[model samples]
Target: MIDGSPLVPHIWFNQSVHFRKGSIMVLKTLQASRVLVVAYPGAADNEAYRKVIGNLEGRTVQEETCKTATQGEVLRMREKYEHSPPDLILGIGGGQVMDSAKMLRVLLENPGKSFANILEGPLAQRSIAYVAVPTTPSTGSEANGTAVIKGSDGVKVPYVTRLMVPDVAILDPSFLSTFSSDQIFTFMGDTFGHAYETMVSKLTNPLIQSIARSIIDLLKLASAELRQTPADARGLDKLMQAGYLGGLATGSVFVGVCHALAHSLEQQKGVAHSSAVLSLTPRCLSWHAETTKDPIYSHLLSEFESIGLQSRVSPDVLAGVDLLLLARQALADPAMKTSPIRMKEQEMMGLINWILKK
Candidate 1:
C-alpha cells in the first residue's frame, strides 16, 4: 500500500526535538475525549508516572498498573473489558505489557472469537485507536505491528499484521532516565538488527531504504556516545528514537538471521531478548553479508565498517554457525522464509571463524 513497502510512517519525538516533533500533536488529532491508560509494573508507584499524568490538563485518566501478567491473567483482563471496552487503549511499558494490551485490543474488537483465532489473523482485524508510551530504551514495542506472546515452549510467538501498528507513539525522554548503560547498549543493537534485516530482506523494497538508513545512523551515533560516556537522558532519548524507528521500519519488514538467532537464544539459551540481540547481532550481520553477498544489502554493512567492525570481529561471530543451529532449533519466525539471502550451516561456521580471527 505504501509504495510496495510494508512499513508505515510512525510519528516520533522526545527531548532532542528543537521544535515539536509531532508525537503529541498527532495524539490531539485523534479527537477522542476519553482515554484509559494501562501501565506496566512499578509505573504507578513511581513519581514519574504521577508527574506525567498531572501535566495532562483536561484528559480524564484512570491509571492501572499491570502486575506481571500470565496467559490466563491476560484472558481475564480481556474478559473484563469485553462488554464495555474503552474508547482508546494506551499501553505504557515494555514488551510484555504492550503485547498484552495488543491482544486485549484484538480480542475485544472481535467478540466470540477464541484467542487462538485472534492470533491467526493479520492484525488488521478492526480499527481501534491505540497509543503506545514506552518507558524503556529497549524492545521497540512502541511502534511495531507485531505483539509477541510467550508460547508453551516459552519462546515469544509474535502476532503479525499491518493493522497492529500503533496510531501514536509517545516517547517522552524523561521516562527512560533510569536505565543503566548495559540496557541502552542492548537496545541499540536491536536498532542495528532492524536496519540490517530490512536492508537485506529478500523482500527488500526501495521505499524503506531511507528509514532503514536513519536507523543505522542513529544506532551508530548512539552506540559510540554510550560506550564512552555515562547514559544520560539525551543519549537515551536518541537511542530509544532509533530503536523506535527501527521497529516501525522492520515490523512490516523484519530482521533476518540476527533476530532469528536471537530468538533461538531466547528459547534455548535462556538469554534476555536484549542480550540475545547484543550477543549475536554483529555476527549475524557478518554472516549474512558474506553468505548472501547481496548487492543491495548496503546500509548496515557500511555502518559496521565505519564503526570498526572490520577490526573488532569477535569469537561469537566466528561461532555464528553454532548460533544458527540454535536459531533453527529455537525459532520459526516468518522472516526466515523471506530473508533476502539464506545461510546454511557451513557458511555460518565460516562467519564465526572470520569474526573470531579478526
Candidate 2:
C-alpha cells in the first residue's frame, strides 16, 4: 500500500493477514474448540491477550509461555501436547513465540519428530492450522515460514518448510503499545535489515525488490513519525505493515551477511538478535560496496545512512567473543548461502574485523 500496487499486499499469501488497529478482534471469530496459545511470559496480563482469551470463553484453551525459543522448549512443548494436539495454535507474541508455535504445530502434526529430525530432513506438510499474532514488529515470523531455534550446542538452527507458514496472521498495533524505547529501535532495526538484505540477496528479483523497497519506505515514514509522537497509531500501523512486507520479501528471497553474523552473535554471546543486526547491517553494506564496487551496494549504504538508524550493541560486549569462531559460525549459517559474495573462512574473518572496526 505504501509504494506498490493494491494487489501487492495480497499477492504473496493465500492466507489471511488482518492488518488494522483492532485486528485482535478477528481472533475471536476463528472456529476452534481446542486451542493452544504459545505466548510471551507476561502475555496473560496484557489487555489484548485478555480480551481475546475472554472472547474464546467456551473454547478449551491451553497456554504455554516462553521467554526464549529453543529446541529444548519445542521438545517440551511437543511432549506436553503430543497426545492431544490442539486443533488450532494461536501464536501471540514476538518472533520467538511465533516461531515456537510454528515448530510446535509442525512437530505435532509430524509425530515423534524433534527439531533435530526436521533440520536433518524435509518436514511433513503442516496438518493443523495456526494463526500468528506478532507483538513485536520484527522478524516477520508472522508472515514467513522460517523458524530459527537455538540448538543444544548453542547454535541457532534454521528450519524451513513451506507448510510452516501460518494459516492466518494478525497484525494489531495495540499490541505494540507496551514496547520500551530501546525495544522500538532494536526491533525496527531488524525490519530494516530484512529489507536491505533482501534487496541484495542472490535470490532477489524485480518483484521482491519492489516489496523490499516498499518496506524501507514504510520504515522511514514510521520512524520519522514515531520520533515526533512516540504513541502515534499511524506510525505503529506503518511499522507493522512494513514488517509483513519484509517477511514477504525475505520469505521469497533471503537475508545474507548481516543476519548470518547476527544469528552467530545471538547463539554465541546471547546478544539480542536485533542489536547484532543493527550493528552489522551498515558494516556489511559498506563491505559489499567496497568489495564488489557495485553502485547497488553503495546506494544501499547511502540509504541506510539517510534513514538514520542506530544500533545499541556495545563493542565491549563483543570484545570477549572469539572473532575467528564467530566468523566461522557466520559462514556456516544458512543465510550465507544466499549472500552475494561467497567469502571463504578467512575472508569472513576479515569482514568480521571490519564489522568490529578493529
Estimated TM-score per prediction?
Answer: 0.78, 0.91
Q: Top lDDT: which candidate number? A: 2
Badly placed stretches (over 4 Å) of model 1 are: 1-34, 56-61, 66-70, 119-128, 224-229, 293-302, 305-327, 343-358
Count clashing residue pairs in model 1: 5
- The sequence of per-residue lDDT tens digits that candidate 2 reaches over residues 253-325 is 7789889888878777888888888777878888878888989877876666666674354555466788888
Worst lDDT window (10 residues) for model 2? 1-10
Q: Backbone collision count in every prediction? A: 5, 0
Across residues 1-358, which tens digit of lDDT does each residue of candidate 1 receive?
3222344433222212211122344444444566667788778776656665664447766666665334565677777777767777878787777777766677777776655676453434455667777776666677766777765455566676545566667777566657776566656655666777776666666666777778777666766776677665456667777767776666656666667766765556456676666556665665655666754444456676664333433334323245556645533665565566556666545654554554
After superposing candidate 2 on the true structure, give the runs of residues whose Cα lies further than 4 Å from its correct spot: 1-14, 119-126, 311-317
Clashing pairs in 1: 202-340, 317-352, 318-352, 318-353, 319-352
The Cα local distance difference test for each model comes to: 0.62, 0.81
